[model samples]
Target chain A: MSRLAIHGRDLLLDRSARGPSWLVPSLEVSRGERIALCGPSGSGKSTLLSAFAGRLAARRGSLQVEGCELVGASEAVRRAHRLATMGQALQDAEMISYLSTVDNVLLPLRLAGRPVGAAQRARAHDLLARLGLSDRQHSRPSQLSHGERARVAIARALIAAPPLLLIDEPTASLDPASREAALDLLFSAEGTVVFATHDPGLIARVDRAFDASIWREP
Target chain B: MIVWHAAALACKGLAATPIRAVVVVFGLALAMGLPGMTVRTASHIEAVMVERAVRTPVLIAPRGSPFEVTLASLYFRGEAEPRVPFFVAAQAVTRGYGSAVPVLVGYRASGHPLVGTSADYFEARGLRPVQGRLPAVLGEVVVGAGLAAQAGIAVGDRLRSDRVRPYDLGTSQPVELRVVGVLGWSASPDDEVVHADLLTLRAIEGILHAHEPAGSEAAPGLGASVFLPVDLSPETLDRVHAHGALEELPVTAVLVFPPDDRRRDQALGDWADHPELQAVQPERVVSVLVELLVRVRDLLLAWSMIVSGCTLALIALVLALWRRLRERELALLRTLGASRSWIALLVAIEAGLLLGVALSLAAGFAWVAPVLLLGALG
Candidate 1:
C-alpha cells in the first residue's frame, strides 16, 4: 500500500466562469489516516473534495492519489482508478429510486465489475445490520427515511472495501446516536477517509484538519 | 456481467412502472396490427366475392342498374325492379345458347331469403346436399348450411314462408314447406339462402294458388278470398296452379350457364337489344366493386401507418421523459463508478424489449384478424 494516500502541492480547485477559485498551498494524507476539510459554506470544501475524487480537473497544481497523477489524467484513467480504489458517498445519499436498499448497497461492487459472491453479500448485510438497516434491506429508497437512505449509502461505499473513501456531510441528516455509529463504522473500516464537513466534533476527532476557508478567493 | 446488470436494471425499471409499459405495449400493437388486419380482411372479402361471381357466367334481368341486377340475382342481397318473364331466359335456352335457371327471390322463410328456382339451379351452381336430397318438388325446400345452422332447421323439418301482404285478404297466406335437404358449405351467399322450386315462391307472391277441395264451390254473387293450405301435400300440389300463362310468370332474374365462352357471349349479345331485358356478366360488375375496395384498403393502410408512426414517436417521447426523470439517478450511478457505456446499454435494452413485445403482439393480431372478420361477415 502507498504510504501517501493523497499528495498535492499548490492545487487550484474548480475555476468556474463566474465564481472565484480556491487554492490549496500544500496537502498530504497518509494511508489509514482520517482527514477533515473544514470550512464555511462556499469556501470550496466540497469543490476540493470533488478534485480529490478526480471528478473535477484542477486548473493548476500537482495532485496525486496513491502515486497516480490526477491533475491532467484522462477521464477513462481517472474513472478506472476511482472504481478500483475509491468509494464515495456524496450529500443526500444519492440512492437510485428504483433500487431497493440491499441492491443500492450492492451497486458499488456491480459497477466495479466485481462478482458479488456470497462473501460480498454477507459483508453488505453485516454493514447494513451495523448501521441499523437490516430490516429495511428490501425496501425501496422512496420507502426509507432520509437517515436510513444515508446509512444505505454508507454501506454501499464500504461494500467494495476500497482503499480510499471520500465523503461529504456524512452525518448531516443523522441524530446524535446514529452519527456516532456512522462515524465508528467509517473509522473502523480499513482505508484513508478524506471528508469535508462543518462539524467541529468531526474535525477534532480526525487525524488532521485542513481549513479551506482561507483558500477561498474573494 | 456489465450487460447482465444493465438488462436487469432495465427490467426492474419497467416493472416498477407497469402502467406505462402496458399502455405503450398495447398502443403500439394496435397501431401496427390494424393496417395488416384491414388489408387482409379486404383481400379475403374480394377473393370470395370474385370467386362466387366468376362461377355464374351471365345474368339476365329486367332493364335496370347492372350492378343492382347482378347483386340481386347472384347474392340475393338487393332489389331488382321490374321483374322479367321466365320465358325470356327459356327462349334463349331454346335458341341453343345455354340453360337458364330462373331466380325468383322476393320471399323469406325464417328470416332467410327463399331463392326459388328449378332443379337445374343446383346443377348450374355445383351445389350438393350435405344431409339429404335437394328440393325435387314444389313444396320441398333446400336450406343452405349457414341458414340451416342459424335458423336451426334440418332435413325433414317444416319451414313457414312469411306472408307477402299479411293485411291484404287477397294476398296469399303463409305456407309451410318441408326442408328436404341442407346444402354443403359453399363459402358463398348461397350458404345463407333457402332454395325452393320456383312454383313455391310464386305461390307465396299470391300469383298462384290451390283450391281447397274437389267439391268446393264459390258463391257466384260474392267473390271469396282463396287461402292456400299451410301444409302443401301431394293433394294440395295437384290443385295448385298459376294465374298467368307459364311463360309470362315473373322471375327476379335468370342465371344462365353457357357451355363455353362463345355461347356466353352470344347469349349476352342476343339479349343486348331486348326492350325489357338486360344481360350482365357478374364477374365484371364484382371486379369493379373489388377494385373500389382495394382503393379503400390502400387508403386505410396509409392512414394506419401514419398512426403507427405517431404512436412510435409518442413512445420515444415517453422514454425520453422517463430518462429525464431519472437523470439524477443516472448521475448518482456514474458517481458510484458506473461508466457511460453501461448506462447507454441499460436504456437500449429497455427500448428493445418493449419493441420486441409490441411486434410479437402485432404479428399475432394480424394472423387472427382475417378469420374473425370473415366470420363476422358471414
Candidate 2:
C-alpha cells in the first residue's frame, strides 16, 4: 500500500447542457505530495480543486481521499470527512467580515464544535504571529490590507492542522514580494498540499504538476 | 451552550446593522404599546365611572329616561331632565323612610355648574368646608375645591351666575350670590360644582327678584341693572319670601338615602307604579353604562389584537427576508462546519431578543399611560 492521499479514475464533471465538461481518465497522488493544478482562466482548475475538497461531486468516477470514498457518498459524510481531514483556503478568502482576525482563525475549531480552551487560544495567537499578523489580531477583516487578508485566510485554513490542505489562488492579489512570502509559508506548511493557480512561479515550486487544459472541453 | 454561542453570533450580526435593528425594535414597541395603552385607559375609566355611581344610592326624578336622570343627578352630565316638584323631597322625608336632598341644575357660573341642595347634601357626600362655612342663608353659596381654585373665587367674593339668553331684551336679570365657603377636594364631579341653597338657585334662575322702590333710580328701563339685588333690604327679602311657594319650586332630581335595605326596597316599590315619577338605583343605571363601555373596550381590544398580530407577522416576514438575504453568510458558516440546526437556532435567538426588548418597552408605556392621562384630566 502506498497510502494514497487522493485516487480518482474516469472522473466526469458536467457544467451545463451546452457548457464544457471536465474529464479525468485516471489520477493518483501519494501522501505528503506537493501537487499544483496549472491552467488559464475557465480551464476547470477551480472545479477540479472543488472536486478534490468534496465541495463538488464527480458525475462518473471512483474518487477517494485517504481511502474514504467520495463519489456517490452522502453530503453529510463528505462534509464530516472534509472537516476532519482537510484544510481548505477558498478562492474568495471567505473571512467573516464582522469577526476580528484572531476569531476568524479560531472559526474552524468553533464550527467543528470543539472547545476553544486556553491552549487553543494560545495556538491561534501563535499561528497569527507566524503569519506576521500578531499586531493585527484584533483588527476586523475590513480593516486589513488585501495581502494581510490573504495571510489571515491562510492562517485560518492551517489552524485545525489537518493532514490534507487544498488552496485556490492564495496569492492572487498579493504584491511580488508578498506573493513570494505567501508561497514560502504555503510550501513550508506540514501537509500533503494541492493548490490551483495560473502562476508558473508557484507551479515550479511543486513536486508534481497537472495541466487542467488537458481535460477542458472546447 | 451551543445556543448561547449562536445567540452571541446573532447579536453581532444585528449590531452590524444598527439602523435596521432599531427600526424592527420600535415597530414591535408601537405594535404592543397601542393596545397596552388603550386597555389601561379603558380600565381606569370604567373603574372611575362605576365607583362614582355606586356612591349614590337612589335617584327620584320626573318620568323620563333613567340613564339621563342618573347622569344628571350623580355625574352632572347630559341635558337636565324635566323638573320634578320640590314637594317630592318633602314627601320622601315625611314618609319616615330616608332623607331626601333636592338637586337643582340648569344654571352655570363661570362655566361651572351651580347646583342647589340642602346642607344635608354636604353631610351625605361627606364634604367639609375647608374655608368659612356651608351656605346657611339665601344669598350665600359654597364653591367646591376645584371651582374655587379654577375660578379664583374666595370667601366673601360675590360671583354672578351666567345670564340665560343674555342677548334677549325680555330675559330675566342675572342674580349675584356671595361665596360663603369652599369645600374640600373629593376627586368627584362634586369638587367642580358651585353649591347653594334652593332659594338662592331660584333667585339665580330669576324665579325671585327684588322689588323696585317707587321714585327710585331702579326703574325698569332707566338704565336698569342686569343683576338683581344681591344684598336685599329686609323689606325686599320679606316680599320675595312671601311670594315663593313650595308647590311651584322645581328640582331636577331627589337623592334619597333610605335608612336600611328594607326601607330602600319599600321606597323602590312605592314609586315603581307612580304614573308621573320614576325612582332608579343609580348603581344599576351606571352598571348598564359600564357594560356598554366594556363592549366598546372589547371591540377596541380585538382591533388592537388584529393590529398586533399583523405587526408580528410583519416582523416575521422581515426576519424571513433578512434570512434570505443572509444565505451567503449562512452558507459560509456551513462551509466552516456549523450544523444546519445551529444556524436555525441563531436566527431564532436574534428574533427572540428583539421581541423581548420591545415587549418590555410596551409594558413600561402601559404602566405610565394611565397616570399621565388621569393627571391631565384631573
DockQ of predictions, in order shown: 0.51, 0.30
The alpha-carbon RMSD over the true interface for every model, in angstroms, is: 1.2, 1.9
Error of 2 at B127 (Å): 9.9
What candidate 1 gets wrong by more than 4 Å, as runs, is: A66-68, A74-77, A109-126, A200-205, B33-38, B82-163, B166-251, B256-275, B301-316, B364-378
> Worst 10-residue stretch by lDDT in candidate 1 chain B?
B213-222
Docking class of 2: acceptable
Model 1 lDDT tens row, B138-190: 78999999878877889989888898787986667788889999999887888
Candidate 2 lDDT tens digits, B1-378: 676567767788888888888989988887889788879878987887787777667788888778887887787777675478899888988986588999987778756788888988998889999999998877788998877886788998877778766785353556667788999988677877889888777776566666555445665455443444444433356655325586557789999988788988888888999998888888898888989988998998899889988998898798789888888778877775576676778878888888898888889878787766764664
C-alpha-based local distance difference test score of model 1: 0.83
Model 1 / residue B65 / CA error / Å: 3.0
Model 2 spans with C-alpha error above 4 angstroms: A1-5, A15-18, A25-33, A97-103, A116-148, A177-189, B28-55, B72-261, B270-277, B287-291, B294-313, B358-378
lDDT of 2 at B22: 91
lDDT of 1 at A106: 87
lDDT of 1 at B286: 97
Going through the candidates in order, what fraction of the true interface contacts does each contain? 0.51, 0.24
Clashing pairs in 2: none
Error of 2 at B123 (Å): 8.9
